[model samples]
Target chain A: MSEFWSDYTVRVVVFGSALIGAVSGALGCYAYLRRQSLIGDVVAHSSLLGIVSAFWGAFLLTGSGNKSLWVIIPGAIVAGLAALLLTRAVTGLTRIKEDAGLGVMLAIFFGTGMMLLRWLQRAQPPIPGRSSLDGYLFGMSAAMTSQDLWMIGLIGAAAVITMLLFWSRLKILTFDPEYAAGLGLPVRRLELLLLCLMVIGIVVGLQIAGVVLMISLLVAPAAAARQWTHHLGKMVGLASTIGAICAAGGALLSAVFSHLPTGPVIVALVTLAFVASVLCSPSRGLLFRRRFVVD
Target chain B: MDIAIETQQLTVAYGAQPALWNVNVEIPSLGITGIIGPNGAGKSTLLKAILGNVPRLSGHVTLHRTDEAGSAAIGYVPQRSAVDWDFPTTVFDLVMMGTYGRLRWFQRPGKREREQTRQALQQVHMEEFADRQIGELSGGQQQRVFLARAFVQRASIYLMDEPFAGVDAKTENMLIEILHQLRDEGNTIVLVHHDLTTVKDYFDHVVLLNRKLVACGTTPQTFTAENIELAYGVAGKQLLSRIS
Candidate 1:
């Protein structure tokens, strides 16, 4: 255990997971409050297509396909935003509800992503990044390098700072969008900003939590924090802390165990935290054994 | 009287069906104006369209605010059901949002903002509930909270959608009093109102609508049985006997 702790690779993996968790957790609060919790799932799943499209674009442009995190992050963002905006547009312009539209986009995007992934794997010359491509699906945190850590740190910090700068508008927009617009805040642009931020947060974390398990890390911490506080400020602060703890702890466990997967471990810890919060939270818990039922 | 708002060929549609069409009316400044109509008469849709809450298929709404900075202070109180009540925010924080219009980019609520929020809450008699979560308030209290938010805006023009719905008589009277106070201060107040019995008493000017403008003038002149019948069609026949 001490030997692994001393290993630079393990440290990077753990720190990277923590950064992803905190950003996803804080941003997830607005989605949770707005009842758009499933958006993260949609974005994460749709980003698979983005990752493949990006790799193909690189392969087509240059002889070598660059599977670099920077290239794929933008690609994932584009795909994720497209999916969300398309869903909103369909919901607004037609009779299709947002949930149905999201579901449809998820299937089409992910289906195309899988098909592209298969084509990449079967390429005669063999794509250089093809072997490690599966890492984006279920994550390969064990392959973390110092470079990955830097990307996560810089991207995560920018997302957090953006949220802070737009704090009041975002809060009003989340709670009452119509009133916010009447207050003269640009509602559509603000909504787009939030969508872009959500996409960025999800895309950045793909390498740490993977597409399949990313939504859990995004939602669980915020959901759990909600049960403990009635204030948005406290809820956000607590959610970030909870997310960081569960992520770091899960990453450490994955590092110690030779065969355990990093994404699933981190996901399970956050889920457990949510369950505990629901059952035992003193203010708004499921428990009926309150020391005093003031009501 | 000066005109605070005028609609020229204002039309709005939801998909293929038009919610409102060819709505042309002038809302008088410095008084209470009632947008009286039945269900699906585009009463709420009219307010929403004017505020750009709903997309307009065509036409325009001209606001003849005495001042542009004052125009930016257009305060709106949406219906109780418009927003999620269970959002994690206290009454103080929610009411403080009214000052957001005046805040510059990257600025936050400061001591001045806090004091304004407190004063607004006091005006609406919601100061006691400042610390409570929004969802914890009663329906009427929630309405007052929304009103406090608008009051904090200190605007020259106020647009409210059904402020009296689902509230007790006491709350209704209090809300009426606030409207009277705002009106006396030379602020133009427009409300999407349904109750015919209170229409004449509550508003100085009224716009009777049914997808189109049935009547638009002073309440005593335009809010008549004949116009009500035209706006509501056959259903309005039943109301004519009750209101008259």
Candidate 2:
């Protein structure tokens, strides 16, 4: 408890978490628009397998417990992309509902990951110098170093630039893909680019926010922001701001008070923001619920 | 004198089910063309195929130039139910989206685009409701907003699907008036119409269809009882009997 309050680590944790949130928030807008909100949930859960696989792969190849962030980053991203492609293929080939497709993909991947993780745990003795990777499961911003913060910040900035470049086409495709294609927009290419972006955001955020809570970061803020505005640009901006605020606030609070899992704390903060939006947002919000009801 | 849209043996299918059969049709460059048919008779499918929103099984759609002046642009307005109305956007914002194709990628909507959106809204008489959330609009208003969107496209050819469904008589008349104005301006307009009574009154050309093209020409020539019966099926026959 004393160690938590006495450090400058709080600043790193909060700043890093906020950046993670902003990235997810921006990407989540597209996910929600494509009517693929639940797909985010599936992707988030599936990344645990990616992380575990990356961990074991690193362990086997390097025999180095110090952990190579470079190796894990690419490994995790590739694995996550594979899972996404598999999900899309299953949905296209079978009569399975999307929800069922997501469920099946999540279960199979996560199960294999758990098996690999257990095998790794039993086969290799604990490295005396290296800390356990369990911190990633729930996220501990206190354990994150400057390198982790740099990774999050760099990825977040890249995502923002991509969004700015293709905002118009992305908005059109998200709103009405059929209409967009009719207008001769590159609908297929744009969608594929968007999917690639989502995978990148999820893979990066999984490090600091953890997969379990990353979906909330991606979806909750955007959904909440939706209640506040009618413009897509404004919604994306507001959602990113709300997500960043929640992430920063959650990380700050958790740092100030020890024994808090940064992931769930950030999610709770985001949930609070969602409730506030529902209660207070101006046009068409849930709080204005009384106005729309007519006899 | 020119053909606006000329399809040579146009055919469209959905999976294994055929929605539209090989159909050759030539359309005039101006005036309202009422496309009437029974359910699953490829009324909407024909428009989708023309718009390239749906895949064409086989055919070529050639947009001819009027005396080498250059071909006209094609615009489409899908059914109101085809999209989620609750999507986060203002009526003005949605209408402005019609100009995306004309604007460059990085550039935002400028004053010119905004003015076009406003004028389009005014055309539909929805100028007062420009700032309204799309979900807040009634079915009729929503349909008008979409019409306004297509109007902003400002293309020479317009293809609309079920613009009259769920609309009030006033809204319907408003739409008809706009269509008339566009026709008078020499823009070709094709409407997927449900009502048979208004074909002769509302449009100059008519396409009667049931899975395949039954008849296509001027209202007097193609809207005959025999063609209407074939287009509408038994229900159309019963209705024709009642009308007579």
Tell me the docking grade of candidate 1. medium
> Compared with the true structure, what per-residue lDDT tens digits does model 1 show for residues A216-259?
88888999999999999899989998888888888888888968
| Candidate achieving the largest lDDT | 1
Whole-model Cα lDDT of every candidate shown, in order: 0.87, 0.78
Query: What are the iRMS values of all candidates?
Result: 2.4, 3.0
TM-score of chain B of 2: 0.94
A68-174 per-residue lDDT for model 2 (tens digits): 44545666677666777897788777777667878888788767766766666666477422345665566666766777777767767887798889887888788
Which pairs in model 2 have colliding backbones? none
TM-score of 2: 0.90
Model 2 segments beyond 4 Å from truth? A1-6, A65-69, A125-131, A282-288, A293-295, B8-11, B65-73, B242-244
Best by TM-score: 1
True contacts kept of each: 0.65, 0.56
> How far is each candidate from the true structure, as Cα RMSD in Å?
2.0, 3.1
Model 1 misplacement above 4 A: A89-95, A289-295, B66-71
Q: Model 2: per-residue lDDT, tens digit, B138-244?
A: 98888888888877877777888889999989889988988899889888899999877777789899988888889988888998888888877678888787656
lDDT of 1: 0.87
